[model samples]
Target chain A: MLAIFKREMRAYFTSPVGYMFCAIFYAVSGFLFMLNTVQAGESANYASYFSILLFLFIVIIPLLTMKLVSEERKMKTDQLIMTAPVTLFDIVMGKYLAALTMFGSAFLSSSILYYIPLAIYGKPNAGLYIGCVIGVFLVGSAFISIGIFISSLTENQFISAFGTIGAIIFLLFVSALNSFINNEAIRNFLNGLSITTRYTYFSNGILRYDSLLYFISLSAVFLFFTVRVFERRRWSKS
Target chain B: MIKVEHLTKQYGDRYAVNDISFEVKKGEIVGFLGPNGAGKSTTMNILTGYLSSTSGKAMVDGLDILEHPLAVKKKVGFLPETPPLYLEMTVKEYLNFIYDLKKCTLNRKEHILEVCKVVKIEDTMNRMIKNLSKGYRQRVGIAGAIIGNPEVIIFDEPTNGLDPKQIIDIRNLIRELGKERTIILSTHILSEVKAVCDRILIINEGKIVADELTENIEGALRGNRRLAIRIEGPSSSVLSSIKKIAGVIYADISVEHEDGSATFIVESKNNVDLRKPIFYMLAKNSWPILSLEFTGANLEDIFISVVDEADAEATVGKK
Candidate 1:
């Protein structure tokens, strides 16, 4: 697992995809940070910061994960990895962790904006900032797992990327689609399904275990699907 | 040692690898000979734990592949039809990654360097795989497969795209590697099997049609006896006189040239040596014999006959 992780991490940097992901992430986040806090002349509230962060996650999660398994399949390198002494869980987790690490690095870099506000205004609530960071990381991890699952389903990286983006966009707006529902039961169900609702608890400094579990479970479900995709391919004749 | 039992792989309604079974003993180099889509790659994939069989099981050493894939995979090295390589990585990086993935605890630097020396890719270790030529990339792929020093090595079309010189070099390397590891090579190149394999398994249409020692298989394909004779005489006289010999099956004039000389290829009855009879008859007829050479069946002939027979049977079955 460590070997696959190291190799995948290096491949990210060696190819232009890794640098492009980092640059786009930083560029968009930096612009959002400046526009939301500096230009607006409002006190730095992590609420706006996190709202923009969610937008960044929706776009960039696919970019970071689109090629994880899809590229391996396209290049036929999955044969080497799948045939090796490693298990399917190791492969899925290794790739997921590598992409998460890359995403985390970019996310952490953008956290520099939090400090800029700290210098200008009185110190914001430290606990809330930490919770928001954790929230973004967990949400991003869930998205990355989704990307991994999508990547495993096809050999075309473009399809994987766009598929993941479409799914995430749908999830992001699922709550809005439920607005017209007059039935309380349907509204509650749709609200629970919204990732933004789960993330809302973190942005407000409330660390709810239920929300955490939702993200973790979501990630697990997708990873399990990824493993099944590989297992079926390995067993079934092409 | 590897044992495959009644293994089958079916794609929807078609059997890519129909009910097939074979065994490879310790320290033996076995060749899987078949034309394209003859289940050579599929069989290798199943053996290496890259794919699971639709029915039956594959056992490596003593453990079943489906039940204990990691254990089987740990002891086996597989090079698929296309060398699975990450083009962005240099040879050294790719190999190091494979070593780690294979969970090798050996001296990493020493082992990798030795493999590089063996495959003759030492100088290209620092170069990215994308920049290397096809042959060098192939060597890198081989180097990766053998990195863990596994007991069994499976190579699928290892020499597909190499030049003649590189083919010879890789063949020699395979021969050397076969000394210690149980190697399974799958290819349509018959001469390669004759050159490197101890036993040959000829598969066609997902069936194991022939499995025997290379020499024994070749001999069986050649049948009990056959001979070719070169004669300096009129073609009709040579044919009639040779046919008159007791043990000879009719003689067919194979070649006729401007000089009016003919070469006849003769198929004789079992346990018959018609050479002396032919010589005496030719001398009596005043048709001097120029040269004679006995021809034996080779791997190519055996492969063709087996596949052709299978195809004919399939056609007959369809009707």
Candidate 2:
């Protein structure tokens, strides 16, 4: 498992995917921090910055994961990996953790760098800032897992990327679609189901165990599905 | 070291590998010979644990593949038709990754260098795999497979798409590797097995149509020794002399050369070395022997007839 993890980490930087992810992340996050906080005369406004970054995660996080499994299948490298002494869990988890570390590193480093200016120019709320970072990282984890899972289903990278987009949008926008419904019970249910609704608890500097469990379990369920995809393929007629 | 029993793999309603059984003892070089879509790759995949057999068992080194998958995988090295390479990585990184992935206990740098030398890819170790030609890439793939020095190695079309020189090089490499390890390689080319294998299994339409030692394939069907020889002497005298030899079934001029030389197709009794007697007779007559060859006898015809027979049976079964 460690071997696969290290290879994937090296692959990210060996190719352009790693640098591209960090670049897009820094540029957009810096711009968001400037527009919503620096330009708006709000010195320590992390809530708006992180919220926008969460929205951006829908696009860029998939970039980090689009080729993870699909490229292996396309190049037929899966034969080498699958035939090795490693188990299927090791394969899926190695790729999953490598992608998590990439997204987390970029997200964490940028969060800290942007926080530095806030500390100098204005008194930043350290507790609130920490809460938002933690919340965003968990959300990014969920998105990355979804991307990896979709990547497992097909050999075409474009299909994996677009399928991730469609799945994430439906999960994130469940709350937005709730306003059209007249029943309060259905609205509450959508609120409970929305990934964004639970995230609001963390972004507001309130730690909710249920929300944390939701994100962790969500990631596990998708990763479980990815491993099952491989297992089922062994029995597949093709 | 490898055994497969009643292994059947069905793809949809069609059986890709249908109740095929075979065994390979230690240090034997077995060749899986068949045409395209003849279940060669499917059988190799099942043996290497890349795919599960629909309803059969494959064992390598006394361990059942499905029951002890990781153990079986550890003992068998596989090189599929296309070398599964990370084109983005330098050969060095790829080798290191495989070494670690296989949980190899050998000294890391030294073992990798040794594998490179074995496959004759020493120069391409530092270069990215994508930059290398197809031949070099294949060498690197082979190096990766043999890294841990597994007791058994299986290759599917190891020489496919290679030039003649590269084909001969890989064949020589396989022959060398076969000396110490049990090896199974699949190919559609007949001469390849004749050149490198000790035993041959000819599969067709998901079944073994013929299985024989490489040396016996000709005699196994024809029950005689056939030789095509070119002689510089007159055609009439050479034909008469060859027919006069002991155990000579028949001798006839197959081709008449413009320079008074002729080629004769000689059929002799089985277990007879007619070349020695033919050589002595020509030496006594002072006629020089130009060229003498087995001509593959009836191996090609045998392969065709066997596969055709299997196809006919399948057609009849369908009706």
Candidate 3:
């Protein structure tokens, strides 16, 4: 697993994919920071900025996870690793952790930009900052997991990326859809299923246990499915 | 070191491999000779545990491929039809990655250098696999297979797309590697097996039709079907009588004898051993035979005859 993780990390940096991912991450977040806080003299506490930037996770997360397994299949390199003395869990988790770490790099790079200002200005709300950071991280983890699971399903990188984008859009778009419901319980239930709505609790300085559980389990379910997809393929066909 | 028993792989309604079985003893080099889609790759995939058989089992070093895949994988190295190379990494990184991937316990730097030396890719260690030529990439692929010093090495057409020079180089490498470990390589080329393998297992339509030593295949083909018979009888009568025998496709007098005897060449249908039928037919007619011998053929003819015979039998079975 460590070997796969290290190799994945190298592939990202050596090719244009890793640099493109980080650059896009920084550029868009920088663009957001410029419009919302820098020109307005509001020292940005990036947690809230990140919560708003979370929608764009759909775009950048795929950049990191798109070729994670799909390219291996397309290039026929999967045969090497699959026939090696490693287990399927090692391959999946190693790649998943590498992608999650790429997301972490983007999060950290953006945080450094956002925190320098917060450190210079008046102190930001500690609870709100921590809560929203956790919220965005969980959301990013889930987005990456979804991206990777979709990647395991196809050999074409574009299909994997677009498929991930479509899946995430459905999950994030459900909250706005809840307002049309006449029944309050139905509205609340639909909101519970929506990923963006769960971020609201964390954005306002509250760490809801249910929302945390939701994202953690969501990521776990998809990661498990990714492993199953590979194992099932070995027994049968693609 | 390798044994496959009654292995059958079915996809939907077709059996990709049906009741296939073979074995390679320790320190022996075996070749699976077959045309395309004849299940050479499928059997290798099953032996490596990359694909599971629908039934039957494959064992390497006494460990079942299905039950103890990792253990079996550790003991076997496979080079698939296409070299599974990560083009992004330098050859050094790729070898190191394979080493780690296979969980090798050898000294990393020394082991890698030794493998590089063996495959003659030492100078290209710093180059990315994508930048290397096809031959260099193939060398790197072989380097990957022999890395970690596995007990068994399997290659699926290791020289499939190489030029003559590269093919000779790879053949020499496989021959060198065969001295220490058990090896199995599959190819459609007959001379390839004659050049490197100790035994040739000919597969046709997913079935083994012939298993002969490299030295014996030549002898086997000579004794196969074509016969040169010198008979003591009237020339026209001898030719007509030989033509009437079952399975004899062609017969003609080649040499006229002044003493009422002649040498005639006899050709038979695929897989038909006409020697016995001709012997009895001539004896029943009270014609003494002067001599009988097999007119030898090269390996190319032998391969075609085996596959053609297999096809003939399959169609006959369907009827």
Question: For candidate 1, lDDT tens digit of each residue in B88-157?
Answer: 9999999989989999999999999999999999999899999999999899999989988999999999
Model 3 spans > 4 angstroms off: A40-47, A181-189, B221-296
- DockQ winner between 1 and 3, please give it: 1
Tell me the whole-model lDDT of each prediction, alpha carbons only. Answer: 0.89, 0.91, 0.89
Q: Compute the lDDT of residue A40 as modeled in candidate 2.
A: 81
lDDT of 3 at A220: 93
- The parts of candidate 2 lying over 4 Å away from their true place are A42-44, A120-124, A183-189, B223-298
Tell me which residue pairs clash in candidate 2. none
DockQ of each: 0.82, 0.77, 0.57
Q: What is the TM-score (0 to 1) of chain A in model 3? A: 0.91
Clashes of 1: 0
lDDT, candidate 2, B1-319, per-residue tens:
8889999999889999999999999999999999899999999999988889999889998899999999999998999989999999999999999999999999999999999999998887889999999999999999989989999999999999999999999999999999999999999999999999999999998999888999988778666788999999877977888888989997899999998888899988778989999999999998888999986446677788788888999899989
Error of 3 at A141 (Å): 0.9
> Among all windows of ten consecutive residues in candidate 1 chain B, which has the lowest summed lDDT?
B217-226
TM-score of each: 0.94, 0.91, 0.87
